[model samples]
Structures are given as C-alpha cells and as structure tokens.
Target: MKQSLTRRAMLGALGTAVAATAGCQSPGTGSDSGSDTGEQPESADAVAQSDSVYTNVYQEVADAVVSIRVYAEDSRGGQGSGFLIDDEHIVTNEHVVAGGDEYYVRFADTGWRTASVVGADVYSDLAVLRIGATPDVTPLSFVETEPTVGTEVVAIGNPFGLSGSVSAGIVSGVDRTLQSANNFSIADAVQTDAPVNPGNSGGPLVTLEGDVVGVINSGGGDNVAFAISAPLTQRVVPSLIQTGDYDHPYMGVGLRSVSPRVAEANNLDPGSGVYITRVVSDGPAAGVLQGSDGETTISGTAIPTGGDVVRQMDDTPTPTRQALGSFLALETSPGETVDVLVERDGAQETVELTLGTRPEP
Candidate 1:
C-alpha cells in the first residue's frame, strides 16, 4: 500500500483532472485499467469458503477499529490509524502523537471523543492514549504466540480517513529488526506483504480467526510492511500503561558486526563477532569496554584495531548486532548484569557490568 498521509495530500492535487473526467461516461472504451479480464474467479466451493472466513472475522472485529486525527497547537496537524485495546485505552504508533497536544478519536459506533496521551515508548514505536471516558467498545486480543511464516493475515485500519478499510496478505517473515525514529532498532518485528499505508500504523494485523498477531506500523519497499509483534507489544504495553515508560538495557557502546573479511584483516579468528568502536564516557560501558586504540590499513582498506571484540554474552556466542539487541530488549531488563566475554590482545577476559537504562535522546 502507499503511504496514505502523503498520498492523501497528493490525491487532493489531482482533483481537477479527476473532476474533468468525472462526467465522461465511457464504460468499456475509457480504459482497461482496473479490469483484468484474463483472470478468472475460483470455484464456487473455494470462493464460498474464503468469503465466509473473512466476512465472519471482519464482522467480529470491525467495531474495534477507529480513525485518529492529531492536532498540534489547536490546528489540524496530521492523521493516522489506531484501535481500542479497552474501553478507555487505545494503542497507536508513537509518531502519531509525537507532536500533538490534542487528539480527536472517531469511531463508527461512537462519534468523536477527546483523548489524552497516556505514555509513549519511542524505542518500540508504540504508544497508549486514554480517552475522556469509557465506552462499550470491544478490545482486540493479541495472540500468545506469533503466527508462522506464510500464514494468511488480515490488516484493518483507516487509510486517508477512509475508516475501516481492510487488506489481506501473508506473514512475509518473522523476527525482523526495524529501525525506530530515535535510531535504535526495535527487535522481533513481524514482516508482512499487506498493503499497510501511512494511516494503517497502529492498527491490528489479525489472523483469520480475529486474533491480533501484530500491530501495523510502517510500509517499506514493494508491498513489504513491518509491524510490531504481538509478543513484544504484550511485553511493553503493560509497562507503558502502568508506568508511562518502559526501561531498556543500555550498554552505551557503539558496536558493529565483524565480518569474516574484517576479522581476517585484523589477523584474528575467522569467526565473526561484535567489535567495540566507541564507548560513551561516564556511561555503562565506559572504562569497562575499551574502544579502538589504533587504526590499520589492510589491502587498501583502513580498519579499526586494538578494541575489545565481543566473543560471547552469557551463553550467546559470536553475537551479531541483531542478536545482541534482541538479548537486551527481550531477555534482560534494565539494571540486570550479564556476563560478557571479550577478546583483548589475543587473550580471553571476562567483564561484569550492571546494565543501565537508555538515556533520553
């Protein structure tokens, strides 16, 4: 799907051309644009089964979807999609309410109602908001486990203010790491080919049975879209609702994945690992994890050397950037210390440091 927020503005600019041709009534002669006559419908039995499943599912969950419009400084600012998790609580993307001082939530059952931001976690790109009052709205349930790859999934949201739009696709992949607004990567993302446009962010990516498996977040190349996994959402949303923030473990060190080429150039083992390039002063890794002490050129390519190369963290061996971030985000909480094994000067050494909280950006 296209990014609907920007698409909405662009569609407005083409109104004149659309209007000029609005009166022209050439049924078959105008264009063969939307009609693909070469394709044929499936058998009656197949079509009936498919229609029954999706129609029944939509009827059960359609009431939970709503349209969210953000207002900045008493003026219409931006718009996106969101869904009710409870009578008073709604979940959406953090960027939706990042700048808005006021919010207007519109639904089919209940009209517009004022809302206030409860909490927003930038690291996860998820936010919670409390409306003025509770209504008789049905909340969607996130599944306990993620759906398998290639399983069919459905997307529901408001695209360009068209409330309650539906799209269907399959789970393209699982356990993806997507970059957040703050430059920190959010781990365990679910990737799908569903047409999730701009307004679809914060909506539900539900199974055929109407169970929420993910939250539609952002659109990427082709029809590829990324969503926050239901497992991650379940883990983070409760803390956000209760405490207004979620704590993530911080190492305060810049790490890069060591490839085989770089490892060979440094005259180290062929197995790849994580290299510490820089350590923030006064931060958790400061004085504990050494930064690059020198630079060397290997085959016309300059590379940093003489830094701590992480071999393992606890039970993990030769972790990449994704592996390390996932362990910190999912396995360990703030203030928890993990045993770190590093290679310094061709010797194995152990370092123990208490994990700290990520400071505000």
Candidate 2:
C-alpha cells in the first residue's frame, strides 16, 4: 500500500527538515556569514544540485503551460490551467471551459491571448482550444509508456489563480475511477499525491523527463489528487480536434461490482466480476445481455440476483467496473462489435453486441 501524509504532518516534517538543515551548517563557516549583503546564503551550485531534476523539468515545460481565464455570458468567470499540445492548440478539462462565452490564455513568455473552444467532450472531461498564435515554445508530449506506481511526477498549473505553480509527488495509484458529470465515471485515471487544488484542472501532470502522463483533474486537499490518464487523453483529444466532439461507446446498463454479499446472492465467486443490474430497454445490450430478474437479502442488505456476471469483454478481463469502463473507453468505438463473456445460471457464454454512441449529457 502507498503511504500518505496529512497536510499538517507534511508541513511539520518540512519545518523539521529545514531546522535540521540550518542546524547542520556551522554558525560562522559560510562565506557570507558576516556580510550585510542580502543575497542567498548558499552558493548557487548547492541550490542547483538540491533540486536539479525538478528545476530542469520546470524550466523545460513551464513556458508551454498557460493560465486560462473563462468568462461566461452573465459576467461570471473562473480560471484554470492548460498546456499547449501543438503550435495552435491547447488541451484542458471540459469543465474548465464549460458555460464560457470567452476564453483567454496566458503563457509565461507572453500576454493573454484570445482562444476558442475547438472541441469539448464531457464524457472524458477533455477539451481542446485553438489560438491564433502561440509563444515560441515546444508543445508538451504525452509519455509513450504508462508510468508505474511510485514514479516521480509533477503537476504544473495555476492553483487558486497562482500562475506557474508546480507540485511534486509520486504516482500513488493507477486505473482509478473518478466520478464525473451525468453520473458517469472517468476510468483509468492516475492518482498522485502531488498537491493540486482549484485552478489546477486541465494542466499537465508530467514526469521528471517533462513528458505528460496525465491531465490534472481534481484534488481533495487530503494529499490525494487525480488526473485523466495520458492513454485516454490521447484517444479523446484527437477526435475532439477533428470533429469538435468525441463519441464514447455506450452500454445502456446499470452495473455493480461483485461484492461478497452480491456474490453470495448471485451464486458467484466472491469479488470476481461486474454484475448487470438493469439493462436499458431497446438499448445495445437489451436483447443480448441479461439483467437481474430477482432480488435477495443477504445480511439485511438487498442484493440484486439472477444478473449476468460479466467476466470479460473482447477477451479482456473486466474484473471490476473500472476495468469495464476502461475497456469501453480505450479499446472500443461507438460502432464496434465486441464479445462480452458473462457467467449466467452458473454457466459461461459469449455474446456479441454492437456498441452505441453515448447520448448527450
């Protein structure tokens, strides 16, 4: 399991480290000890070495990160962060530009420039912005490989209107599911301990090598924050740019992960797969997939029974709701036909279903 630090504890530890470091230096040993000059007490070399990796990443990527200010039709406005993905385009969260009549972005090297929403996808919480011209900075690229747990990462964004802010921590979890609008969940998310707050959304969560691994999504102020994974972003952003929207494959069915009680009620292996609670009438899985036909009580808890327990989709094991959502989001398209393997009546069977485009939220 990953370790966590409360805000008070983290600050306390920082204070202790500072105090211990100060105590380590001899009182009259440094060259500027007796001087009245207000320069830094430590040599430039020492300061550079202390935070070389973070410093280098910040210098390399900060120029391309932008602060976004959004103005709504009714004089309401908010701010968030984003980063350039190309010479003329920027990537941000869909929620950031929602209900905005005007969008403006400011780069570290340039003044605020007018921008337009080229596309936005609420399902994935990703949006693309087009600017007439951008500062002479290289666009950030997503990491080619998935970052493993404990990989060092940084969140670069404007938090609470503070521009050019950077926070550092390790990737604490992967393949996480985050709640989104429309009662849906954003799947395959990356969780980090990097301190992100309001206004950090839409910014790049990059690795030490300056490659973006995720897009900063939300933070709970409890040493926990989440980002849309780079793999999902890569899938959604291109379609948004090309067509002004992205179509998500939809399965119109309510699902629940198989828990101990649910497993017992449904006669399933404990904690094995996802259960289909209700399949929408006339929906993609209406005729092909089976939903729960009865309910039972286990330990005074009502559990849906007689439902299809989905074990796999397209040969990919969907052991949880997160795995199922990720498979639909990343591996299939709106019109693709996928093989769904489910255990029904204590027997396993495979069924093919053509996916459908998700309805507007």
Q: Tell me the TM-score of each prediction against the true structure.
A: 0.81, 0.88
After TM-score superposition, the amount by which residue 308's alpha carbon in candidate 1 deviates from its true location, in angstroms, is 2.4
| Candidate 2 residue lDDT tens string, 183-235 | 88888999999888899999999987789999999995888999999999999
List per-prediction Cα lDDT, in the order shown. Answer: 0.76, 0.85
Using TM-score as the measure, the top candidate is 2
Give model 1's TM-score versus the native structure. 0.81
TM-score of 2: 0.88
Q: Residue 7 deviation, candidate 1, in Å?
A: 36
lDDT of 1 at 147: 88
